[model samples]
Target: MRMIQRRIRERGEREIPARLIGELVMEALRDLDPVAYVRFASVYRRFEDVDAFSVEIARMKEAEVPGGGDDPNRGD
Candidate 1:
């Protein structure tokens, strides 16, 4: 939770909205564990159907590859 706390501190605000906390959690989870990220996102985003889950999975898969646009250190 330190990372999330640091994110809030970095924002330099006394109060942060729930959305921002969720965003921080999503980002940290995505980088730390994709599977866990998807699980959390499914609940956090409140996916109504399987199509939404499929789309998120596809997006995460794309991000896993080099130069898929989520990384800046590719080919280094």
Candidate 2:
């Protein structure tokens, strides 16, 4: 992760492919413990502010909504 960050910083404005980043993350996570994955994701996703983290969580919750509503039991 630090290597990726350093690469980006050293090569400013260069485009890094999403697939490459995803592959790198997956490889890194494969050897990491669950808690380490969470820690890495929190920083990697730039959840520095509470609102940013809240927005990401809300997006996840919304995706879980089958029919897109406040109902708890509905699957679709």
Which candidate achieves the best TM-score against the true structure? Answer: 1
- Per-residue lDDT over 1-76 for candidate 1, one digit per residue giving the tens place of the 0 to 100 score: 7999987999998889999899999999999999999999999999999999999988887787776756655452
Best by lDDT: 1
Per-residue lDDT of candidate 2, residues 1-76 (tens digit): 7866765567576788776676567446635554464455567776778787566556555655676557767553
Error of 1 at 57 (Å): 0.6
What's the residue-level lDDT of 66 in candidate 1? 75
lDDT of candidate 1? 0.89
Report lDDT (CA) for all predictions: 0.89, 0.62
Q: For each candidate, what TM-score against the reference? A: 0.82, 0.41
TM-score of 1: 0.82
| TM-score (C-alpha, index-matched) for candidate 2 | 0.41
The deviation in Å at residue 24 for candidate 1 is: 0.5
